[model samples]
Target: MTPITEVEGRRLPLSNLDKVLYPATGTTKGELLHYYAITAGVLLPHLHLRPVSFLRYPDGPDGQLFFTKNPPPGTPDWVMTAPVPRSDDPSARQVVIQDLPSLMWAANLVVEFHTPQWRSDAPAVADRLVFDLDPGSPATVVECCRVALRLRERLAEDGLVAYVKTSGAKGLHLLVPLVPTPSEEVSAYARRLAVEAEAELPSLVVHRMAKKLRPGKVFVDHSQNAAAKTTATPYTLRARRTPAVSTPVTWEEVEACTDPGQLVFLLEDVAPRVGMYGDLLAPLFDTRGAGSLP
Candidate 1:
């Protein structure tokens, strides 16, 4: 493992990643960091950056291993390294979010910034939504990507947007950021939306939740559409074998693939290929004031 990167008063553990390769596309924790720094560098011109969380694991004899979503501050130019963890090995895992404040220092691009037009006074439609998809299953991920993309398009057409992030463990999250609407109402609206979506895309997707019913398709799981329900934050470094950073991507990317191979990425990777930033899906939270429905 590598030594800690010294900051103002505290020394932050930076690298000595404890991850196994993902085969042909397998990447080292170090490579992941590089990917992030490169990506963050691209966004230095836009977006408001935030703190990072770090997921650490020990690399057996190698000592502590780690990865990150947000790396600790003063990361020594961003080398991928993690504090050693306690376990055999995680096929995948959560690393960390660090040096949060510094993320703003690196902001440069925007994906869907509309702060100028945002109006909080508008009636709160459905705020705070979570779309829980499956992660362990590649088929589920693709199925989910399809459902989410369709939702994004529909929402966009309706003048609403949704902020998307991965579930980090098994699925993707399509968070419709509303201005704090009641949870039940939001959940109700979500159910309605799900019904409509399922009706429209019955051949490719389904909203049914019973395991016996899911077969091989994705479930919208509108159950997550309830209030007081918070989805895992995007790019949150989690605990696991290989640390998968939750990220937001383009609608096209979501539509083209369902492979976990294409799903997760380092926090650094989110902004680069994007060449922009902003919660494109932020508008979905605004509700139409329709009371909760059965």
Candidate 2:
């Protein structure tokens, strides 16, 4: 019989507690549940009302992985969901993790939580802008940091404040809060910034997605601003050889980082860091005070 637990008055059947989800670090299913439960306070704020796309790795990182925007077949009826319109197909009802029970319910099966810049209620408007800085081989995250610093200064000049976070992989993500704007307009503005970054730091940055040009440069991916695209939600665990988290960081930390290893944050490091610094990306929630595109 599967072990049953009660969370926020909801009955949940948690199984495979001993199954290893991260082979290299030996992280198990139960540990992942605990991580999400403890971080729910800080994590739920970022996910509230946003339509999430789950990236599941049921058998672990080394096994098959899949992405699903719609709720899985057996999803409990109590879990909140919202209808998200699509350009090509009929609207799909996507999962919305607005509270602890809903969050833990999804976390039990998902390794990565991805959400668009707009919330489910206002699907046509973008509430934030994202820049995914990916470094090519020989150029690691240290070089990406150098580029992020320059981009930060540029955004400041435009009256926008940018917050930094680790992609939980090899690069950095810079997000800027915005007063509600059309997604198309936001994407255009982001592309302009990417172009400016490339021109200003040609030797270190590349705006286009050409693999050949990325050998020793940092690719500034601004396409995630599209209404149909999604970015990994902050504090969400990434599927990798080990348990790493898409953790938020301060600009001071970005400025001080020189080694690639310095930015790598495992699941164990997140709760303590949040306890010390609070949510560094908390400013992203101030939609009313956010700046407009110049």
Candidate 3:
């Protein structure tokens, strides 16, 4: 095992290097070593023994994270993201995770929280429902963005404040945070939104449960919005060679991205650390008047 080094502000102890392995993917090559090295450095302080995980983004380096052996059951995926230059004109070097074991070790030390303010102990005040929309055709990423904005407006009108974040892949996720309610009600709310989507973009969107039924169109995935269900938290680090994270984006840039695969942010590019559950998703922590993290 190698000693951990400090970068930015975190100190990483690289004492473990026997448990991690990298899967081969064209997204990045032979760079898993570097990724693990960095992941261990970034996530070591937050690890735990439970099967914890979150999506990673590719911003500064290739996308990947040193975490979970495999994601927990019911985890949402393809939420991975990577940051890319408007142009790779200089053909910069791809970042890498050099030590797998340490990265994997560090991964275990961190506790991952998705489904914001999700708790089995404390009373949940919000039910997080997300509509992660992906295009069915090659028409354009903007076309999908147009639909996302329309969807966000529609959700907002219903009293559920909608926040938009990049899947860090190609799609945009419309998040609706509500007072913590049961799954059945959450599912129903999702169903209503799905219906609304179909009504608003009859030609572009479909709510059919059967994937085969909705050909060449965007489908509203109400399934993820179910009670106790979760969507990848925006800016989560995923365990892939090229670390990808979910990103919050301005609606204008949403339409400009071409490939759904290209719009993610890397761990290096994400804001450092989180304050409890993080403020972007602060409503989940509101507990209304419940007072501090319980």
Residues 170-219, candidate 1: write the lDDT tens digits.
66777655555555676766777778887997765567776764666677
Counting clashing residue pairs in each candidate, in order, gives: 66, 0, 53
Largest TM-score belongs to which candidate? 2
Provide TM-scores for the models: 0.53, 0.98, 0.57
lDDT, residue 135, candidate 2 = 98
Over 206-251, each residue of candidate 3 has an lDDT whose tens digit, in order, gives: 7776766566677666776543345555554444344555656555
Best candidate according to lDDT: 2
- lDDT of all the models against the reference? 0.48, 0.92, 0.48
Least accurate 10 contiguous residues by lDDT in model 2: 84-93
Model 3 misplacement above 4 A: 2-117, 122-126, 239-242, 255-262, 272-294
